[model samples]
Target: MSLPKSRLLVIGCVWPEPNSSAAGSRMLQLLQFFLAENYKITFVTTSARSEFAVDLEKMNITSEVIKMNHPSFDEMLKRISPDLVLFDRFMTEEQFGWRVDEICPEAVKILDTEDLHFLRKTRIEAFKKNIPAEEIYFDADITKREIASIYRCDLSLIISEVEMKLLQKEFNIPQNLLHYLPFLLEPISEEEKLSLPAFKNRKDFISIGNFLHEPNWNAVLYLKEKIWPLIRQELPDAKLNIYGSYPSQKIWNLHNEKEGFIVQGRAENAEIVMKNAKVCLAPIQFGAGLKGKLIQAMQCGTPSITTAIGAEGIAGALDWNGFITNQPKDFAQKAVQLYSEENLWENSAENGFRIINSRFNKEAFQHKLSERLLNLIQNIATYRQKNFIGKMLQHHQHRSTYFMAKFIEEKEKR
Candidate 1:
């Protein structure tokens, strides 16, 4: 006898726009993982669609528009009755997890953390306050909520190994509860590398990220105020191309053609832009998880000059693609050196290929994740039994959050 086909309901915070941001790309990658496994997916989101949002229908994936604190979601969830419910982020889980738990107790709950929200929040706080890394603790309110959400779910997907270690060591989150799933990608072929613009041919330095993210915006400002002046001094003609989605008026205000600082909002083709660039610059002061822009730069055969924080997790026991420095002066100098030296650029690009092949081989990651899900499905009851704390948190949060949602629903009706 054959096993029955599995159904998955993915509640997204927003519709995916893979071209717009790394988070969007990450979401599509996850969806593709399930689709490849022959899992029937129904992607439902409460957020309105963006112009850049990928059309799920084109991929033959069913999608629905959902509402928060509404009874309608329960009915819809009940009708589909997915074997697995994957929350896009902790926020999405907080919104609809209780309803799913109540409606279908047997459905396995999975939280795709994208990146640890609490970790990112803490890093942002530390960066602003100039607090020592050692002083940073789990005192923030987001920490409580995010950790609780982690426990509430049967399994949580951690995208970075650093984050997985942090949760296990600092927070004492059980290893069984979390699984590390980095960006799943195939190794680049020799032909693909040859097709990329050669080091000598590529010109100018580029930086790309979603401007809506605080860290990305901060990095851009750091480049303009401190880092860029030194780099501009070295390469007067070279431009720093700033590309991202939803650039606010303030973002555009910084654009100055005289200074060789260009804020080109929303690249129509992010990869193409990266391909043509000699070097990528992301002087990230604070953030968590692997930096997607840096990864993209590597794939495009473009070396990057980023801070230690920017290069974190992605470069494990290997030489960085270009250079990693915390100082603004050193970062600028490295960017200049990498831009001019073809041999150094090629060596760095080779290191990037090594990291991708060993760390993020798509097939190996997919197989491991599939096995994990299968085991959980078979032994969900026993798994839940081991996670007594998860049950306690779930029991309490469900009761409290349930009433809060009810109050909102009642008010909205009135």
Candidate 2:
């Protein structure tokens, strides 16, 4: 029997901006997956339009502008009455989740947590002081809020398996409530990969990520303060090209031609930059979730040397495409070695191709995800009944959010 096609409503924390963030690329992947499955998608965001926002019209995706902290959202959601509603992040879930529960009671609620904000925040706090994860966990206030958001949704899409286990062991969230879905991608064919610039053709060592992310900024600092000097001492002429969007003054100030460090902000084509780079370096001290820039590096047929934390939740049991080392001296040595050895670089590049195919194939994850959605739609009552914690949170949040929204509406009228 043919299953009925679903009408999906995705409430975004902000519009997808692939050029600006990993979060943006993640949203585009989700949109493409739904489009491939022939589902109708209506993406709604309360954020005002920006130059960075993805052009939905260019991609044939429907877009809607919503008002923040207003009853108008309820009316908007009711009029659409979608079969499934996806919240882009925890904050979006917090704002619109209650309204969806009230207006479209039967609709399946999915939380696409691009990455765990709480984990990222906690890690940043610890990194700033150079403390351990255990020390950071005790004081993480955002985790409580993010966890609450997880329980309120029918299913939360997690990008990292490490995070999946963390939620299970630390937070005690039910397995049914979480879905492990990494970056959805098509496997790069040998022919396609061959078309990429060879190791000899590529030049320099490069690292790129959205600078707004603390981890990327921190990684850059680690490279400058510790790694780059060692690398330059070994390979005197080797250059390090740093590319990303929205560089601050601090990031710009790091640019020094004599030192072989260049901060090239916002790649006209991110892949083009990666394709020409000999190696990607990410000496991340601390962070959460998968690093999209690393994935992009591999996609561009460029191998990388990253820390254990930088490679977290990415490769699983598979051998990393390149070296994974945390030591300052060891990281720099590998970067120099990988850049100069064509055979070594070629093998690592091949490993990258395998990693993406095995770990992130869109068809593999999408089919599993589709089945889970079908099961939820089929036995939603039974599923919700089993999730007593979700029910409690949903029930409580519904009352609290509704009254708070009502008060705001009344005040605005006066």
Which candidate wins on TM-score? Answer: 1
TM-score of each candidate?
A: 0.98, 0.96
For candidate 2, lDDT tens digit of each residue in 1-414? Answer: 222556889999888988777889999998887877677889889888878888898877788798876888878877788988999989988888888988899888889989888888888887778777667775677887799899888899999999999999987889999999999999999799989998778899898988988889989989999999999998999899999888999999999999999999988888888889889999988788889888998899999999998999888898888999999999988988898888999999998999999999988898888788778878889888888888888889888888998898889989
Ten-residue segment with the worst summed lDDT in candidate 1?
1-10
The lowest-lDDT stretch of 10 consecutive residues in candidate 2 is 1-10
Estimate the TM-score for candidate 2.
0.96
lDDT of each: 0.90, 0.88
**Alpha-carbon shift of residue 36 in model 1 (angstroms):** 0.7
Candidate 2 residues lying further than 4 Å off, grouped into runs, are 1-5
- The parts of candidate 1 lying over 4 Å away from their true place are 1-5
The top-ranked prediction according to lDDT is 1
